[model samples]
Target: MNTMLGFLLIMKAEIIRGWIITRRYWFRTLTGLIIGYGMLMILIAGFFYSQPAIEKGINQLDDPTRATNYILGFIIGLFAFGVIGMFTQGIQGMAQTGVLEQLCMSPYGLVTNFLARAVVASVTTIFYSALMVYFVVISVGGKLYFDPLPVIVLLTLSFINLLGFGFMVGGLVLVFKQVGQLTIIVRMALFALAIFAREEFLQQGWLVSALMHALPITDASICLKYVLVKGQISETGQFMSVFLHPCFYWLCASCLIWTFIGISLFKIMENYSRYKGTLGIY
Candidate 1:
């Protein structure tokens, strides 16, 4: 089908996006290897490192809450680096390499193209979170037996939520430290939770609690915590809906809104540049 073909093309272009950045830096081969495996090792180590604290909190609790919180904290914590984590350098790399312009000029399927780019990097977040658990097991440490299905579903939901944010930030990169800063801090906070979060972290602080509810991530992260921690298998569908159903549709809507804005801006800038005969000046 034509629709299927379009999807394949989008995936093809996005899968190779990192190579473009590496080529621009003349570090294609070297950086590829580093990003490829170095990222995995760090993810493994982070998960491993955070397990003790997860278990520590678990031990202090009476029964199931201990296991529940540890699992919730551990999984949701890694959410810090989820798809949003790829932006750590992916955003900068794309902008610096002038890929923003290139992306806007695609032949067709702009949303699919951009989503592919976002998903490609989002893999790093998944890597780090899974490794955390793997390393803990290898070290002969306290390990929580998590049901993989829920975690996978939660991870998928979180990644879809971030795809929208990535698109909106594209045009603002020229002068947008505030958004970038906020992103970094949120990433750190989430990663911290992935390691271990206390009730004090989730319940007591008014500011933190407020932010938790307000951020897009709070939806899935909480869903993950509840399903994993509370043993609420029945709530899984609702939690998945809260984040995946509406969030993805919103993300898709955002992509359309953002791409429209981006195109409008480009046209305006192009016309102005043509009048001045300085198109490449930017």
Candidate 2:
């Protein structure tokens, strides 16, 4: 109970610190919001505008509703990427700023503080995602089929998998002090998994489809697109359908497995860094 209370306090402090930073640089904040979100909206518009061929392809599926599914998937994926990247880059930033050494010596421990900051950051991402979605839907003249409960549930699961990925990155940063190349590869892989998996051409073969479905964030993206753009609510009263679905189950299993791997690897790297007396080294 005491530990939980302390964690909550730290989380609150972190959130306040974030608000202070944002407020102190309100212009930068506004500029970042405009540029980042504007770029996303513009790119999405460009994709659909330039590629009427894709629309024709979806029309071939006899599902006219899919006209906007890819765009929506990209939006959701971008949101997820932002949330996960915030955590990963926060850890990396600590290293770059020589804060990791102090954090290592703190009573709260590096992992605890990192997780707390990440949770706080992720809480705000929900609002960011909603605002982006609202603007995109309005601007694109697209309809949304929002089932709040399922969307929340699935998105949370997806982020759990991402949290594990963040842990891995954090671990690497602890040991290597720099992983620019690895980071790029991981980020692009995530982008592909989340954004490109929606392509029907990739659905060929049992093995290929299974692999795509099992990829982290892919299934969640599909289901989220279904709920947000297609109006298909599998169930709200019962949780069984969400769990029974292949994508959903894959998400759960992958979260469990990857989280275990991530934490274990991070712990190992943290200990090694400490043993080497380089925990503070950049």
Candidate 3:
């Protein structure tokens, strides 16, 4: 009871502090969301708006499955872009402002600092996703078959998944000094792979599933569709798949492991920065 309040207060402080820093670097964050939401909604509009024609055009599966698949594909596309926005902005902010170092000076652990930035970024993401859904409603001209409650749940889980990506990318930034190049390639890959190009994208055949599962983004997409489009949150399979998802949890666990790694890397850089006298200034 009392302990939970204390924890909440501390988390609030961390988020507030991160929020302040965010104002100083507002362009990248704001521009990212704006561009992301704009582009995504346009594509989503195309898909749902075109679905009726697609179903009528093909005599294959009658009505519902065609529409269902269309909606599922849109959900994955949106989530993939969400991942790109999250990791891109996350790594950029850490590398640009050295916020990681600033937060490290505090008594709070790195995990708190890491999570705070995630929350701040999540504020923007939440807005964008809501707007996307609203746009989806406008395009489709209907409400969901079931309550949207399950999607909200899956969205929260997806945020946890994003945390793992943020930390891993931040780690790369710290070690490599500029992972900017890899960011582009990763962005393209996420779009191509998760945007519904393939049916068994992350979990198909043994070999393909093995490869896709190795990347957390893959399972995150699969689980996302299950919970969001299908309203399968109560399913044992969907929930269990989350725990087994490599990119989402296994790597998320690794992020906690890498917090220590970040500390060690920061210590080494601290020494070098002190010798070079560039630690605090830049």
Candidate 4:
């Protein structure tokens, strides 16, 4: 109980710190949002221009599910990067500014401090991502079926999965100290997976399907689509069908497995870094 309470207090303090930083740098935050929105618009324009057939098909269809799915996938990719960035970019920045060493020496420990930051980052990213999704949906006239319960449940799972993946990357940062290029490549791969992964991929082959299901975002993306875009709820409007789906179970398993692996790997890397006296080296 005391440990949990201490962790909660740490999270609260981190949240307050995050809020202060955002408030102080409101202009920078707003500028980032504007730039992000502009980039998204450019991508949409390029996509439509490059694929005339898809554009025409979207025009002809009343629902435009394909377009909606594309937008959702983009949003998911952004959320994933944002969550993971809290560890990758955040740690790098701290190291460059000579604050990382101080953090390593703190009584709270690196893991506890970083976890608090992750929680705050996730909440902030979700808010901004939701805002962006809303604007994109309105601009494109896209339709989405949003049941609050399932959406929340699926998003929570997705966040947990992403958190674990972030820890894995964070572990690499602890040991490597300079993995910018590699992290970029990995994030790009994850973004591509988010956009294109689907249940149909599972039908290709067992090995291929297993690998896809093992990815952090694949099952989460599919589950989110089922609830938000596909509207695969029961006749009674309950989310039982979603909970009963195989992908849902796969998501649960992925969350457990990835989280355990990520945390364990992070611990190993942290200890090695400490032994090498490079935990705070940029």
For 42-157, candidate 3 gives per-residue lDDT tens digits of 66546545666765444422344343444455555455455545544554555468874665565554445555545655765566665655555445443334445545555565
Q: Which ten residues in a row have the lowest lDDT in candidate 2?
A: 58-67
lDDT of 4 at 55: 56
TM-score of each: 0.55, 0.84, 0.61, 0.91
lDDT of candidates 1 onward, in order: 0.50, 0.69, 0.53, 0.81
Best by TM-score: 4
- Candidate 1 residue lDDT tens string, 102-123: 6546654444555665666566
Our tally of clashes for model 1 stands at 6
- Candidate 2 segments whose C-alpha is farther than 4 A from its true place: 49-67, 199-210, 233-244
List clash counts for every candidate, in order. Answer: 6, 0, 1, 0
| Best-to-worst ranking by lDDT | 4, 2, 3, 1
lDDT of 3 at 206: 79
Model 2 C-alpha lDDT per residue in residues 1-282, reported as the tens digit of each score: 755766787799889998999899999978877886788777765655576697764343334345356556666677667655765566567766887777777677766777777788877777766777677666656678777787888878777777776787778777775673357666767775666555363459888876775556777776676566656644363334444555666678888876887778888888987887666666
